[model samples]
Target: AQSVTQLDSHVSVSEGTPVLLRCNYSSSYSPSLFWYVQHPNKGLQLLLKYTSAATLVKGINGFEAEFKKSETSFHLTKPSAHMSDAAEYFCVVSLGSNDYKLSFGAGTTVTVRA
Candidate 1:
C-alpha cells in the first residue's frame, strides 16, 4: 500500500509569485503519483501525474511536479501564482494499475494574496 503526506496544511502566495506545495510519499513498490486541485464548489481537476516514465512531469495551468525516488517526494510547483489558483490541492498515490483505488492526502489549502 502507498500513502501520502502533504507537508503543509495551508500555503499563502502573493499573486505573480512562485507557488510550491510540498508532498511526500511512502510505498512498498514503484508507485504512481498524482496531484489534483479542487476549487470552491468545483470538482477535482488533475494537475499532473508521474508513473515512472519521467522524473519531471508537467500538467495544466503551468503546474508541474517532480518525482524524486531517493527523496520520496513529489512536490508540485508553479512559476507564478494566480488568484484562480486559490484552492485545495491533494496528493494522491496508487499502488497498482487500478487507478480507481487511490489513497489521497489530507490536502493543502492554497490562499493567493493580491
Candidate 2:
C-alpha cells in the first residue's frame, strides 16, 4: 500500500516571506509523488512530480520539493509568498500499478497575509 501524510493542515505566510508545507509517505513500491495546487473554486494544477528520476524537483510558480527516501518525506518550499499563493495544496502519491489510483493527503490550506 502507498499513502501520504501532510503534517500541517494550514500554513500562514506574510507577503514575500518563505512558505513551507511538510509531507511524509510510505509505499510498498517506488511510488510517484506530486504536489498540486488548487485555488478557490478552481481545478488542480500540477506543481511538481517525482517519478524515480529526480530527487530535487522544481515546479511552477517558484515552488519546489525535495524527495528524501531516507526520511520518507517530500516537503514543498517557496522562497517568497504572494497573496495569489493562498490556496489549498494537496500532497499526492501514485499507487504504481495498472489501477492508476491516487492517494491524497488531507491537504494544507495556505493563507497569505499582506
Best by TM-score: 2
Residue pairs in clash, model 2: none
Report the lDDT tens digits of candidate 1 across residue range 1-114. Answer: 689999999999999999999999999987999999999999999999998999999999999999999999999999999999999999999867555688999999999999
Give per-residue CA lDDT, model 2, range 41-65, as digits (tens).
Answer: 9999999999978899999999999
Against the unseen true structure, what C-alpha lDDT does each candidate score? 0.95, 0.96
Q: What lDDT is reached at residue 62 by model 2? A: 98
**Clashing pairs for predicted structure model 1, backbone only:** none
Local distance difference test, candidate 2: 0.96
Poorly placed runs, candidate 1 (over 4 Å): 97-99
Give the number of colliding residue pairs in candidate 2.
0
TM-score of decoy 2: 0.97
Q: Candidate 1 at residue 19, lDDT?
A: 97
TM-score of each: 0.96, 0.97
